[model samples]
Target: MGEEGTAMRMVLCETEESRRTYTLNSFGQTISSYEELCYIISGQYLYFLTEGIPEGMREWIEEELGLVLPAEEETKKQLEHIIGYRNYFTVPEQRMLVQKMRTAYLYSSVRKHKMLGDLYLKHSRYLSAYHAYQKSLSGLMQLKTKEQQEVLYHTGLCLTRMFRFQEAKEFFKRSCRLKENKKCQEAYFIVSYMHGDYQKFLEDGRALSFTEEQLSEIHENISGMEERFSGSEESTALKKIDYHRKKPDDLMTRRLTWSMLERWKNEYRREIV
Candidate 1:
């Protein structure tokens, strides 16, 4: 009985070592060499290891190899690169980079489309940007949890640019609820202001419905512009019309409003004989 128990212990020990050996070999397959695995653990080969691997696989590889990988640091660096690319690139350059990233299936491709959407919106190419933003949003939707809030916020920006203000407001509100980020707050305020503007324009036929503070700000801005043009002959010849009086009539406003309302209408309009 003593000899049998000793044999069982020996078998268990061998099985554990074999399992460890298999894990080590699997790590070897993923990396270039045992030396490269050591470099990865030491944070020197992180870029090479992460280049072709998905985000989910990195931790598993780290655990199996008994290595401590700088996954968070690498992610942060990638995000910084994405933001820099967005801020520095021109419209054509951004579009070109987005196209290349998409073709290569790079992890940054979704972010590139999102940044391209913003560039297009800045250039006032609203419809084109909306498509790009939508694609970014779709890519993010596949991710779990609230990881896609940035994509949602950018989609709201695209909708607002396209003059789909109500839809944009809803999207922004949802994004704010999800992430509570500064971008979402800014989008919320813009949507709220635009909603009020659209209502004043359509319902009351008012050029603007400003609060006291907003009126003061607008007056200050106009006064500043007036000073710049004080000596110009063109400024003297310019007629400052009261836009309130010239506000579109109810009939015209209704036509504009109904155009959007018709999109939500369910009935089909048929031709009469």
Candidate 2:
């Protein structure tokens, strides 16, 4: 081969390799431009993902930069939502769109479920948040252990808000078993109080990181509840359940928890009044 012809062939070969190393996939789909390479390399793609892109911006990204995203229907819907609402509304407002996006495919998306759970929690919709987090935890395609502890914590918080203290206590303990945090410890104590396990709480709580002031408040609350119910029964002041105790199945446990939740709500109302 002539020198110039050989040099041109080498340049073409190097360009193809550069594309593969930078933006081309195994199937040979190439990102259109050097800007796409820059975005991928700099991690700025994440920023665009969070902020979302307008139609004009999307066109610019595709036409000017040649970065085509995956075109899956559910993914497109989610991406549009993520990109469409930048500086327009609070995330909670955007989260209402979850109900709109609740097709089977979207429901199967853990990211969607988790986003909906966050919005539900943000608005104090504990029941909705609980189920959403549960769905995310049990996602079929990929059960992410990375968020399991957080899911446990949030699910426990939801149960606590719903007045299902026993279940809440159990979930918090599960989260703590995975990884301990002060919030989880305090929440465990709070649920223990609600579960009427005051003795266990006081004994075990001493080892937790609650401030002395918080501990004093808990003591006062426990004392009041005890004084009022001392002659009634010591259900909460007793030891924790034994490991061999027969736990109910999910459906039965849910039914029982719902039944108990109603009673607790009435009791809570009476106390407040």
Candidate 3:
């Protein structure tokens, strides 16, 4: 956090040298432009106010930043507007706010993106949720283990819902690596199984310390999927594995396998010709 008193005492920049000086005096942040300055001021004020401002500090901050601070009533109205309509902000506006919030606090953007992701996920907007989670992950710096794991788990869920099982499994794997919690471990196992790596799924379930009952539950879930998707491509792959053939199962694996086959066919076209 930038020192409020120091920020108030500092002079506005008119040149590169003065900007450098301001940055040095503030939070070691480089303020290059007017927009950057506004972001910094708002973000710093937001953080300071959230932490309880000292007496008369608010007036000084407002004066120094050359802006009128929003009153409680106005603030409430703005919050209502933002929260009431999911489409109140256009895509660009939402992105701009996310970037601007990054200047206010270390974790502000991350938290904002996570909130957006959860909202999108709840609405079944998996692609939007995935992008929001990606941004959240990108903003992570020196975050706690649980925080990182949480973002990773949710990212996996987004991918899973999109039917990108291979990518989802990778995310779940990364989450499990951070901390082998049951939720993440179970997700990883399910995703791995869904991606057609049943053997690896079973091995990892045990190696990752999942209980026997959990493993059985996971297996039963897989069995249920097999029964539900019978005669489908996924079920055919599962049946092939059951019969001991080296067949790729699951939608994603089958797609990749078919893509490879297509490439092979194209390569052999010249010989056939």
* Model 2: per-residue Cα lDDT over 1-273, one tens digit each: 676656432111111212232222211224444433332322222222322333444453455544554445344364444333333333553354433433323334576666656655664556667777877776623545546677788888877656566888888887776767778876776566554444566655665555667777876764565455433323332222221244533322212133334444444344334
TM-score of 1: 0.33
Q: What TM-score fits each model?
A: 0.33, 0.39, 0.43
Better of 1 and 3 by lDDT: 3
Window of ten residues with lowest summed lDDT in model 2: 9-18
TM-score of 2: 0.39
Number of clashes recorded per candidate: 0, 3, 1
Indicate the worst ten consecutive residues by lDDT in candidate 3. Answer: 17-26
63-135: candidate 3 lDDT, tens digit per residue: 4433344555333233223322333344665456655544434547676576566655564455666787788
Ranking by lDDT: 3, 2, 1
Worst 10 residues of 1 by lDDT: 264-273
Best by lDDT: 3
Write down the lDDT that model 3 would get: 0.54
1-273: candidate 1 lDDT, tens digit per residue: 566557432111111111222222212234433333332333312223233434444454444443344655554333223323222344554455445444434556565566656555554455655676677776776544454676677677656544466788777777776765767765555445434354442332122233656544544543454356454543332223211244433332322223222322211111000
What's model 2's overall lDDT? 0.51
Residue runs of model 3 more than 4 Å from their true location after superposition: 1-107, 203-221, 228-273
